[model samples]
Structures are given as structure tokens and as C-alpha cells.
Target: MRVLAGLIVASLLAAAPAQAQTVFAPDDPGSSGQPGGWVNDQWNFLPGTGVDAPRAWGNLIAKGRPGGIGVRVAVLDTGLAYADRGRFRRSPDISRFRLARGRDFCPHAGPGEDPCDGEDAYPDDPNGHGTHVASTIGEATANAIGVTGLAYGATLLPIKVLDRDGYGDQQSITAGIRYAVAHGAQIINLSFEFGTLVSSARQIPLVLSAVKHARRRGVLVVAAAGNAAQARVAYPAALPGVVSVGAVTEDGCLADYSDSGPGLDIVAPGGGDDALRPGEPQCRPGVALRPIVQMTYAGSKHRFGLPRDYVGTSMAAPHVSAAAALVIASGILGPKPTPQALEQRLKATARDAGPPGPDQAYGAGILDAGAATAP
Candidate 1:
């Protein structure tokens, strides 16, 4: 099986609180009832500890685009629970957002053999990872149900490169990248990376070429730095022009499992145990922090729940992707801003973390969606 850069530990079922303070209420009522409850569970969107999504939401609301409207973000990973067909069911919270008819690049022989059979027209997520990542980028805001996506107004293109087992080869991933660019995806979120063992970009020439192709086409590619806790970042993300994102915990410290090194661009909330950093009060080693929560399949594709084990740089990349979409919609960099401009804005507006300047661990620092899209 091909190795995925992200780590998926065992999960526990958790429910959202029924009541919480409302931050920014969208005009549209969500499919579910409790719009305010998202504030209770989503600490990753809070002011200091998280990305500060409310500020971004308010900015977008003033601009008339509530959640990065018109931006198309392509999620390249295991399929998403986007559509309901056969045994699959879309996550209740994610159902409200607009989705493109995404393609499945990884095709297998029989349905019984692989969950992601090539027969389907839509990229339905058999593994919950892609769905979780997509939801983080554009799940649906103020929709009462589970949680709020940073760019809920943006269109999501679910490109299934990995199989149900969360394993994918270079060919499928390469195809997925090219497909997203050709399909007008403004931002591509790559939440999975090659193993740390596959260190050199020379090893994955096709994937690297595809990423460069996307960059040339002005598509912003955001990727996970990897979760190996290694000094060097993993491939694809480490590639030039791609926004390499690392993971930070609830305490705003680097996640214990997040890989760090040169080429790392930014950091976001991935949620889990904090790394041991002397003098940093937030870095409480050994304490189990709350994981990034999103509505995903409980165990089977038929059931949907909030699983609290989704932690890694894989989880961190989508936050940047969503922020990129918001920046695109905000008109801060004009209507058609280049990927480089978007990256620079996100890094420049990011809240500084770790050391004094941009370090290897925290990159440009934790993502601040509110400030990045501020008018």
C-alpha cells in the first residue's frame, strides 16, 4: 500500500453542543437548526488559538460575498461524501454547499475489491479523510448542524486521487492535479503527502511536474508538510511554488506530529498534542489536545458523525486553501490575483508564532483568516 503523509489515529464519537454564542450569522439558515453551536466545537476558528474565522466572515459579509463566493477549491484526496448514491450519504452539514461533479482518478476492478470504483460519475468519499478536508475548506457556515467551513461560499471540486484505504500512487495524484487546473479550480488543497522516506522531489517527477503546471496556470496549491515529526518536510508540499503548511495545536504551538523544515510556508490548527517547547506556556507536552472536528463518516460511509481523531498537516492544508479562496473573493488583490500574491498575503497577514521571525516549525506563523481578508 502507498503511504499517506497524514496520520489517522483511532476516533471517538463526539456531539456538538446545542447552544453557544453566535459570532456571525449568515443570512441563509442551514439545513440543521443550531447555527450558533459551531462556536462551541470549532476552537480552530476562535480568535487566538485558531484561525479567527468570525472576523473573516464579517469581512466577507460586508463585501457581499459571505464565504469566499465564486472561488473553486479542488480537494485532492480520497473521495468525499459529497453525493448520496447507493449506500453513501452526504454529511448533513456539508450538504448545503455547492459542489462540482468531481472525477475519480483512481479506478479499480470491482466494487467489492475497492471502495472507490471507477464506475461512479461523482467522486464519492469512501474514506472519511477527503470529506473531512473538504468540509474544513467549504463545509457550510451558519448552517446549524455540525461545524462551519472557512470558505463555505466557495465551490468545492472533489478530486479522488487516493483509495478508501487512504493510499494512492503518483500517477493518480498527478492526474488529479492536472484535472483540477484544467477544470478552473482556483485553489487546490493537497492534504496528503508522500512518505518522509521518499524525500527527494527527483523521486516523484510526474507529481512535481503536475504541481508546477498548476502553479503556471495560476492555481494555488496548498499542501500538508507531513506528519512524520521529521526535520525535513515531505514531497509535493516541499516542492517550490506550493504553499507548504504545518500543523499547530489548540495551544498555538506546533503539533507534536507535524513535520518541519525548509520550504514550509505556513501553519494552521491541526489539533492534537503540543510539541515540547521550553518557555512557551502553550506547549504542554503529553497533554492530549482536542483534534480538529468536522462532520465525517463514523465508521461506515452510511453513518455521519464528528470524529475527534483527525489530526495532522493534512488537516492544516485545507485551512490555507480556504483562506486563499477568501482572499480571492475579497478583492484585496484584485479579481484575478496570481497564486504568488495570494500566498504572500496569507503569509504576511498570518499571526507570528515560534521564535521572532518565520521559523521552520511554524513557517510564516498560524493562519489568521480574519486578517488575511480584512478590507
Candidate 2:
């Protein structure tokens, strides 16, 4: 019995991946990809970089037709610019996929009323949050333009649920989900979350019902757990059936600001404020990795100009959403995978991180797109 047990342990040890491998930026993202962007950074790839989902998963993406094409992902946040300002825009460059017409549900008639005042005829992200999240989801990757996105083949629908102040009520979010579900969005990326923990009860039926509606329609909802720096996850993420995500640094650990607990499903490279690991600098280049990179709006005088950076589970959630889009587009899971099926694939294929099995910190594990999309 001792000899048998020893053999089993040895086999297990041999199969395990190197836990503390060194991480470094790739010499180049590609001939088309430029440096200084988060997705182009080394953390998005290589075994030991942060969440451990390498961009090598992209090799499969190149061998086949672009997978995310025809898959529509709704960015239920601020919005995206219809016109080109700086290097970001919703058309021409990002025109590979068809962008669905979006709407605004900002309430002028109070928290949950129908007499809401919609902003523009088209979606526009003034606060820069929605634009950043949308770009991370799909930003015309490898087009010899700007930074790359994980699923550049996916179409983005800019549903403006949050206002210029980056604040939105329950009704707006509820309305946004319903709109996306009704309009045929395969995935809904909800990077915004309530600041505090809120119960999903009858009083909050609109938002809860909307999430339920999306699930029923087979639309995947990916959300940020929150930035509370504690164990409690906030609402939307706290609700049932949502894909809750937490943030991690580029060194394969949870960020100091990411929220965790019952709701978190997985983690992604959201970067850190002052990340610490063996043989790494205290801060990334110019507040870079501290806040994950994406093409966004900066009012004036900012890095990346139209393409800047931000730190939070907000950044992390979209990376997961992008991975989901990649999986759906890859056709590896089948032609039309139900939301539940896709979610299961993600959980099953995720690289195990933190304590073995599922834990709040890393959930099933950091998302492994390559394995998830593998034949």
C-alpha cells in the first residue's frame, strides 16, 4: 500500500505545472500588435503571468476563421463613441463584426420609472468606463491600428446603462439587460456593479427579472464582483446565475482591491495598484499594469489618449467575457451552446489556481482560453 501511494503522489507531482515561474513581457505582440497595451502585455500570455490564460490561445484563433464573428456581446455600461476621437471608434476599424444599434436607459424620472430620458440617438461613452470595457471585449486586434482584444472578431453593442457620472439605478440596468436579451445578444458584459451588497428580492424585481430573462433567452451575463477589498461580493454579481469575476495582478495572485466570496466564478488580469511578487517592480510602467489596459476615453491629458487604463474587477470581468466570446466563436463547443453549457466549459477548462478545486479567490481557476477552445 505504501509503495502504491508513493507512486500515485509522484505521478501527481510530475503532472503539476510550475507554480512560481518567472513572467516577462513578450518581445513583440505581433507585426500588427503594438506595445504598451494591456492585452499586448506579457500578462495576457505565458504560463506564470498573472491569471495564467496565455495569448497563445490565439494561435488557434489564427489557424481557423475568426470565431467571434456574428457573436454579439453587449457592453452594459457607459457606452462607446460613434465617431473616431483619438484611436478608438465603433465603426470602420472595429467594423469587422456588425454592431447592433444600442439605447440609453438613464432615468430622468427617478430610480425605476418609464419616463426616462435617453441620451443620444446613438451610444457614446463620455465617462470612458464603457468604452474601455467594450474595447477589451473586442478592439480590432492585429489590424495594424492600435491595441489588441482577446476576441476581436466579436461584435459590440453599446447599451448605455450608466450615466456620465458612472452611476446608474436598478431600472436602467434592468432595462439594459432586457434590451440586450430581446435584441439577440449572445453575451452581456456587465462590468459595473453596486458599491454595496444588495439583496436580490422582489423589491429589486426589475434587475433580478432582467437577469433571469437573459438566462432564459440563453444570453451569458458576465459581471464584476466589485472593488471592496473584502470578502463580500456586491449585487448583480451576488445574484444567482451571473458569471461573477474577481481581479488579479500580473503575478498570479488576487489584487488587493478585488472583492471575493460566494459569487466569484473566476479571475483575470485586472492588474494591481502596487503589485508585489518575487523579482517584479513595485509599480508597472506609468500606472500601467496597476490598471489593466484598454482603449477608452480620457477627458484630457491621459495615457493612450482614447486608449487608457483602469484598475478594478471591471477590467477583469470583460477579459472573461472576451474569453467566452472566443469560445463561442471558435465553434469548439458546438454551433449554438446554451449559456449554461458555455459557462460549464469555462469552469471545466480553467487553469486551477490558488487552493485546489474551487475557492472564492480564484474560483474554478484563472480562465484558460487555449484549453477551453482546444479540440
Candidate 3:
């Protein structure tokens, strides 16, 4: 049986790429320069409340040379498909980040399906979750187009462990971790997770072992705290050496669906639109929290005008992963800081959100991209 099911869809507001403006109207798809749009506002360049990814970008760009070009992030999820052009109907944003081709654990299961085979090659995301997660990490920033990611300068190593259904077995996931570690992913984003892990050794030995392997090699593994409303920790997230992340609303309250427990590392803006769940209270348009925005497969070819809605801990993990990228790119931690040192930097610098310091609800606190990457 699957440990968990996919989350309910949030209120997906579509935005068209219009001329730069400051309006937050639904009629406006959204531009990259407006504070009303959280992606451009709270998540990007705007000061104080924003994650401050653009600040890191600014420091790097001002140097006249690109930063984060050498850091490689491994996205272990469904797959990566940005979009397409003349000869290609699809191109992953990982390409825009200029990352090398990583391995796909699943063998092609014919057209329109992704299932594992006997080979250690080819990773493509048909299910969209992986692509959305990747976009949050490095979707190409400040291009006068889509919303930016935290570390647009970093390269990607997309690894397709999960198939179309958003589920991957312990074997595939462990193998994927090993591949990432061996191939050199300084950071690994585990946006998908298994719920109700009873005993690590009994339920997921390989998974735990893989995490340890990554840690031994100085790789930081960031994972989702799961979307369960039941205030408990999930596997991998609770596992040692992994940074567990939960979701919080824009106002800094814990999200309605975010899971929490002893090991959660931190929280991020994982927009919650109650309307997405049936029978749940419907939040008025402006009054409701805005979901995180990024460019990815919307199943309807690249529609640039509409802001796509995706809200969950899955969305939160990458923000931290990208922040890790920014920290590495910033050179603040030195050319080769140990994984433990980098993780401590993240936890120590995080903005305290609830109960003063390091509460289970918000971990160390909400991620401070600005503080984490500041020179």
C-alpha cells in the first residue's frame, strides 16, 4: 500500500505575461516586477518579507561573472520538462540552468508512461510534480518572463525516481540517492515523501541507508514534511541527516495542512487556498493565501499569461534547497564547507517565526533567503 496520497489541488489562478505593472488583479496573469505577485514580491526582490533570492542574484551578477554555475542540485522526483520550441515540444528548465544530463532510474514504459527498467539512464517527468519542484529551485531568473527561482545560477541534476502516479518504491528512491551522491549533487531535494514510517529498519532500511550515504559524502538532503494534517513527522524527513520542511502561510502562521513533529527543520510559504479541498472553507480571492508560483508543465502547453497554483510542503523544500545553492554560490561559507557546516548556517540564520526559537511547528523558523545568502 502507498504510504501517502497526493495533496488536494489548490485554487489555481492563471496569469498571462503582460506588460510590467504593480496591479494584483486576477485579470492580470502577472509580470515579474510586481509586489502583489508573491513570486515577484515576497519570494523574490522585494525586501524584508521576501525570501531574498534576488539579493543573492544581485550580489553575484554585480561581480560580472555568473555564480552557482558549479553547484549541482539533484531533483529526485517525477522528471523535468520545462517546455518546447521548433523541433522540441518540451525542454526542461534544468537545461536553462545549464545542468548536465542526470540519470533516470525508470526505463521508458512506452509512450506517455514512466516505469522502472533494468537500465540506469534517462529521466523525464511526464507527471508535472518534478518539473514544478525544479522550477522553484532554478527556473531561470530576471529574464523579463516567468517568476524566478532562489538559485537560478545553480545547475540541476534531475533524477526521475517517481513515475506518473507520484509514487516511487524504496528501492528506486535509495538508488536515486546513491546516484546523486556519486554523480556529485551537493544538495538533494526530496519533495515527495512516504507517510507513517513505523520503524526505519523495518520499513525503509535502504532509504535510511541512502540518506546516511549522502551525509557521509557531505551532501545535504532536504525533504518535505508531508502534507498530512495529522501533526506527525514522515519518513526520510524524520530520518537523521535530512532537513525536514513544512509549509506556512504568507502571514507566517503554520499552514492548515502542514505536518509537524520533533525533527522538522523549518517552514516556508507553501500557499494554502482552502477552496482546493472539497467541503473545506473557501477563502475569498484576495483574502486567501497565494500559492507559490513557477513555470512548469500545466498539461496545457506553455500558457504564459496565467499564474499556475501549486501549494504544499513540496513547494517549500526547494526554496530551502535553492537557498543552500545560494549559500554555496555566495562563497560566504568558504570554497568547500562541510555539509554539517552548511546545514548549521541554514538553521542558525533562519528567521524565527513561532515560540521564539526552534519550535517543532516552524523548526528553526521560516527560511531567510536574504540572511542565508547575505555577504
Give each model's whole-structure lDDT.
Answer: 0.84, 0.66, 0.68
lDDT of 2 at 27: 25
Candidates ranked by TM-score: 1, 3, 2
Model 3, 187-217: lDDT tens per residue? 9999876876543545888888999999999
lDDT of 1 by residue, 120-209 (tens): 457888788999999999987665567778999999999988888887878888989999999999999999878866877888889889
Which RMSD values do the candidates have, in order? 4.9, 10.4, 6.8
Which segments of model 3 are wrong by more than 4 Å? 1-8, 11-48, 62-67, 82-88, 91-97, 107-120, 197-201, 273-287, 301-307
Q: Quick one: how many clashes does candidate 2 have?
A: 2
Q: After superposition, how far is residue 368 of candidate 1 from its true place, in Å?
A: 0.4
**Per-prediction TM-score to the true structure, in the order listed:** 0.92, 0.79, 0.81
Which 10-residue window in model 2 sums to the lowest lDDT?
A: 1-10
Q: What is the C-alpha local distance difference test score of candidate 3?
A: 0.68
User: What are the clashing pairs of model 1?
Assistant: 34-144, 79-125, 80-125
Q: Pick the candidate with the highest lDDT.
A: 1
Candidate 2 per-residue lDDT over residues 283-302, each given as its tens digit: 34234343465555545423
